[model samples]
Target chain A: MKNRIESKSEVDVSLKDLCKRFGDFTAVSDLTLEVHKGEFLTFLGPSGSGKTTTLRMIGGFETPTAGEVYIQGELANDKPPNKRATRTVFQDLALFPHMAVGGNIEYGLSFQGLNKKERKTKALKALELVDLEGLYERKVATLSGGQKQRVALARALVTEPPILLLDEPLGALDEKLRERMQGELKNLHKRLGITFIAVTHNQEEALTMSDRIAIIDRGRLEQVATARELYESPKSEFVADFIGVANIIRGKIIEDNAGVKKLLSDGLEFFIPSKEGFNIGDNAILVVRPERIEIGDKARKSNNSFSVRVRNIFYKGAYLEYYTVLESSQEIRIRVESKSSSQDTSADYKTTIGWNESDSVVLTREPK
Target chain B: MGRVTVPKRVSLWAFTILALMFIFLPSAYLLLISFEPSELEKVPRNFSDFSLRWYIQLFHQERLPGAIRQSVMVGLLTAGITSFLSLLSGMSYRRLRKKSYFLGLLIFPMFVPGIIAALSLSVFFRLISIRSSMYTVVLGHVLYALPYASIVTLVSFSGLKEGLIEAARDLGASGFRAFKDIIFPLTRGGIFGAALFGFLLSLNEFIRAYFLSGWQETLSIYMFGQMKGGADPSIYALAGLILSVSIFLVLVALIYYSFIRYFSRSFA
Candidate 1:
């Protein structure tokens, strides 16, 4: 009870030991997190990873089978969606097709005891805030995909909800439009300093638009941190692989000297950063990013360097990727910016590859 | 759209004209005979003999106008009740797990023969000590029209995307408010369409009205009685009037269907 009171005072929303099960299938399990007062937080996961289910639970659309949900420090497990202080922009945009843009935006205002004139005034204001000032009278069907997305945002905003929940809000837009809206959404969050809880499967969108991102996998909270922290220091192999391109090297820690550790795999030796509780003979996983592995003359200066045969090269417009393999048949990918002068102008050449000790992240294998 | 050969286009036009003529020929014959001036002649002897003599006499009959009024009253009541009930059933159909089973049960009455249904309803009302009246006639008509009404309303509800009601609720609208602001307006076209179907079905119904009518006969019953008693020129005039009214209503329904189609998809 004391902890509950403390959480209510500090957190805008709290989920404690929350679990949701559909028959034998557990959609969410014992998940707990706190959303701060005014921050952009994203729940990022793969499809069917329970991110949307968690968002629905927060918005009062789904009741948890066990545990509790608190909004502004008050227990809200029994509250209906309309009684909660959260509004959601659905995945499909679910704008009322029968109503004009103004009518859709003004729908929530009517419930707040605002008269017809006041509702119109507030709806027009919301439309302008979304950069659609003159589209209030326009029919929803006449709007383009991006315009419809803005109308959906304006509709949810007009209610002045403290917590705005977006379920893949830009999932329907084209790629370029999606990126543009991502920027617009970030701006809106800054301008209106309200809690924004968005759910998405797109890792890039989550990284670009969120103050903090919570990584969920198979109904479990894997990690929650800022984008930089999550990318630079992923705690698990799943996080490293899911967030971006990672070259995971699995081996046993065979040597620990000073603050550096030596890992041995397939008769090859690699150096990694050491942490507490990592002793000799314990198996570990190392996550080395592609761009971090330097080739050519720069490889000779690194602590852990190896010779590899270039297998293939892919020109990726912005960067060039070289697929190389070591003598032990282990594959490695190296990303070099397109403007770099590291191009050898030929394939099937032997080249040395290396990364600094600190750049390789070591993950201690969990006990079975 | 591939380009059609000239012969194919001509044949398509010919088939369309033939279908239209097949549908309207009987109504045209009724209109022509109603103006025959000779009481015994079924068709007008000459275009010059066309007159409004039977039409003037048709309205003077004591019971015909009253019968038409009662039939309209019954039709309105049936349409209102069937549409309201169908709305409830249609909305519930969305929430049901076994949708096909529920719909099958709702539409099961369509298979029952009309004479059998009318006789059973009359017997059941008598067993319950209920007298024949317009309300009873409405009850029978609602039973007959509900299957079609529910289908129409269900189709309308299908066009409504999922999560709309939930979105409205998330935005602070209560359950009732969501229905008023979202559900009703989006699907009102279907509801109105269901009501029109019920009105037409009830107006043309003869078997149930014959068994369940009160002191005042319905228009169908009166027309049936007049046909059996004598083949009068005034009866032909009455048939022409009924045909014209039915055609007008059908035209209105067609216009409404096109209007809603345009209104809903103009932006798309």
Candidate 2:
């Protein structure tokens, strides 16, 4: 099952045909992905989707039941974590409770054969790198949650491994703190310019931090693309639905003419831009992003317009959500930025909503 | 956090006092007689008659010193062996799939009656032609104490997050190095608790010591023998000393445990 490629310096880590089975349950199955050097790649999936197991296989914490892991072009399937050129900031942070901040950071240096004084100097430098300059002697139990997270990062970074694996790195923080750490981590990744493969179930965190997002579902790799590409042009219904809020309209394509395709479902019709591999009379799926749909007066002038009954309007802080239903009784949620004071649609029960043909993508139905 | 009602508070205080008296009254009587100069007198005749005469007489007993030495040796050996084995057992439990079954097997000895266990061990030793001694006493005590020690160690092991070991290994520590630097230091409280359990169990052991000890008697066995052959005031003094030492050790252990707990809880 080993899918080896010619050694390339640009790729830092590669997994091919990776499968892990615990008894009758398969956690990760025949998964393959290539992580480029100096890129921030995230394994994004829902819980129990085998995202963490895939990360563990890359980090050498778990051996794939069948497949090959290559680190820096060398086969790493049998290599223990310590022997691999990778370090992980575990989900719990896993800071050594018995050691002080300096000692925790200095732990990896002990194996490097550095003298105690040199190790202290390097550990202090690493501490300063994480903005905890003077708290070298502080015990882990005395540090706050955010400080402990930074200490975990600093400890893993002190070893200077070529690849850093973060398993839900900010999963333990509060909402406000998590958002702040996301920015800090992105900046840290930029400054270090090393391969950072993070595993997270947070779609927003993945969207904000990752250079490339690999969406995994039920142990299979659904899609791997940039955040913008995944959001705008998802190849599968699963990728489109999992990456963000999407109104997935399932129907059979009835009209294929010029550069547009018309899909009919029940009593309604939808016009979307023609896409490859979708033929007339084929059951295809259409993915329209919530933010891409236009409502009220502006929607009437778009390529595909519909008059829908507005069920409700939700006032989110930065935007407004219009929960509308079409003639066929399908629910559609439209998100419109509330930058102006006149973006209200509460007075009218019937509203027009439409999206440009290019705003929605056509994806083949995922096999049941 | 709820306020206690008057009747409930009063009853609680009364129950506490009664429990304390139930536990300490007999020991208090022995402690009072430990200060008397004469063996026949139950208490000091007067406050001015109180003396350390019996305590001094304790050292003069020929077998008492040897018995104490033998007991201490047995306690130290039992504590060391039990703690080490229990720690290893606790570590293995994490990797075991059928954990409850394995735990039940390890705890089976604790369910056996002490007298029956001691008699069987004594018979087994004789059948093997192994003479009963302090070493045999230690073996029996370890068998009795290991279940308790392992339970304590398992409790501590449970507190250890699996991520810590994985993080250590990710940071380039070998398995042995990870255990030395992380696992042992973090779970030392449970290991120490196990050791204390082994030491105390071996010290207070009577039935197994009575069955396994040959020629030289343990302190408990020696004390029992003295009670049967005209009780000595020195035995009361020894009882008072053992009680005080045990209380001091327990107090020290409690303080140390709380200190570790406090340190661990600040961030948790």
List model 1 lDDT by residue over A45-89, tens digit each: 999899999999999989999989988888999899988878999
Q: Write down the worst ten-residue block by lDDT for model 1 chain B.
A: B259-268
TM-score of each: 0.91, 0.94
Best by DockQ: 2
List where candidate 1 sits over 4 angstroms from the true fold.
A1-8, A23-25, A251-269, A276-284, A364-368, B257-268
Q: What are the lDDT figures for the candidates, one per model? A: 0.90, 0.90
- The CAPRI-style docking tier of model 2 reads medium
Q: Give the native contact fraction of candidate 1.
A: 0.82
